[model samples]
Target: MSGHGFHVHGPHDHELEHAASGGGHGDGHGHADGGAASLSGGMSMTSKIAVCTAVIATVGAIFSYMGGSTQANAGLYKNNAAIKKTEASNQWNYFQSKSTKQALAEFARDTATDDVRMQGWQVKLARYEQEKTDIQAAAKKLEAEASQWDAQSEEQMHQHHRWAQATTVLQVSIALAAIALLTKKKWLERAMFGVAAGGLVVGALAAFHI
Candidate 1:
């Protein structure tokens, strides 16, 4: 009877053993479920971060292109302004020379004593006056053209400054996006998007010459 009692489990002990085994199996299943959930969550976070990175990269590339194009345009305008200024100066000098000739012809016509000599000087003075009129018209036109070029160049430079500012902001936004991915901060990501939006607005303005 003693040996039988030692080898045979009672009903209560059997129930406890079964309960313990079932509890262990349930815990293992729970752990597996939790692990799967964690893995899924990690993948979702990574996907979001990847998307953010791609979008930020695209915006940054556009900003860089706009900034570079604006800077190039500014340089081109400056060169055009220089050419126009040089032409204007040349025209003014030509006008001055023509005026000197006209003045000399007028003085000679007034002072000539002989009839033939006075008549010849009067004809020459008339020719010089007509030439001066033509030269004055051309010089004034050239000066106006130079002034227009100067204004245009200044406008281009202003647009370039806008584009440069926009590019700087976009670059900062890209850095913030990278940091957002590392920190997994949704608010930081949103702020980065905000800065990117501002950059886009500025870039658009630059493109439109506003």
Candidate 2:
């Protein structure tokens, strides 16, 4: 009455005020319930997806590192194989030199007129033959070592491939996770888990050197 107009109360005015107050409170409660439901349902899915994505990312990183390590090992083993091959080649060359020396010594012994000179040539021939034998043995040994290193390098390369495959699958899983988060599709989440499991299996294969 003081502000604008006279105020009047009907017989039902108190009930109407009470009803309005209750409706307001009910509307607030409904909104709170809706928020809680969203938290428990949608937010719950989001949290699970986030956690799984994080775990998958960590596993993918490990797989990537293992791939790199295996690749490095393969390269190192290949270098070792090359080094051994070079050593074998050197030994073979040394053996060839000894063979040439032995041939010359034999010729000298056969053609020599003096007995003392013949004896000296014979001694030289025997020494050269023994040296050739030793060098041949060393060369064969180095060749065998090179073969072993080559085999090891091949194994490492295979393992590197496995790790790379595992990492790639995990990366796909991470991509699916991002898509699921964006689209809120349960099917995408399932696919993400399946891909992630496949990635883990590949990683296991790599670990066992399969």
Candidate 3:
């Protein structure tokens, strides 16, 4: 032992050993931090998906409402025009009957009163006919516009619904993936895969409906 100019067990050696043990403890803490970071990352991703689902659902509902409104307006316009046409036709018939009665009652065959009455009746009839035509034309135009609006609205609604459904599926899948990661369950991971596959099929079916 005296032959070695230094002591085998020095204070520095003990200090170095203690520092090495401390470094191992730090390494464990580092691993825990890394795990926590991974969990947080998963949660952030899930939150994003949930937000997207909400947005898509809102859009779908709006489109459905708009389509319904257009259909209702179309029906209203058509009904109103039909009622007006019926009323105008009834008034014209009444006027024609009155004119015939007055003309027959007069003993004079070619009286001015008869001519004036007939002319008046013709003018009323012409006005009624024009009104009827105008009403019918307006009704047709409104109906066509309403139908076009309904078609467009329905298409938008379908698209929105499809997106909403897809978002829901994605949200579920993300939740499942997070659980699988946390619990390290093989079954959950497999189940998540199945859910994702089913979602894709459902989305495809929705697209076909569109």
TM-score of each prediction? 0.80, 0.86, 0.43
lDDT of 2 by residue, 21-71 (tens): 795478778999999998799888899999999999999999999999989
- lDDT computed for candidate 1: 0.79
Model 2 stretches with alpha carbons more than 4 Å out: 1-35
lDDT of 3 by residue, 46-155 (tens): 56545644553454454345445545555555555556555555555655565555455332433436777756655665565566566556655655565565555565
Best by lDDT: 2
The worst-scoring run of ten residues by lDDT in candidate 1 lies at 1-10
lDDT of 1 by residue, 1-210 (tens): 576665667998887897887954687789999999989986787687678667767866876777777677767877777787787788778878878887887788789888899899888878877887887788778777777777877887788788788888888887887888788888887888898888888888877888
Counting only residues 3 or more apart in sequence or on different chains, how many pairs clash (N, Cα, C under 3 Å) in candidate 1?
0
Kindly indicate the candidate among 1 and 3 with the higher lDDT.
Answer: 1
Ranking by TM-score: 2, 1, 3
lDDT score at residue 176, model 3, on the 0-100 scale: 75
Higher-ranked by TM-score: 2 or 3: 2
Highest TM-score scorer: 2
What TM-score does structure 2 among the candidates reach? 0.86
* Sequence-dependent TM-score of model 3: 0.43
Error of 3 at 80 (Å): 18
Q: How many residue pairs clash in each candidate?
A: 0, 0, 0
Residue 145 displacement in candidate 3 (angstroms): 2.8
Segments of candidate 1 deviating more than 4 angstroms: 1-31
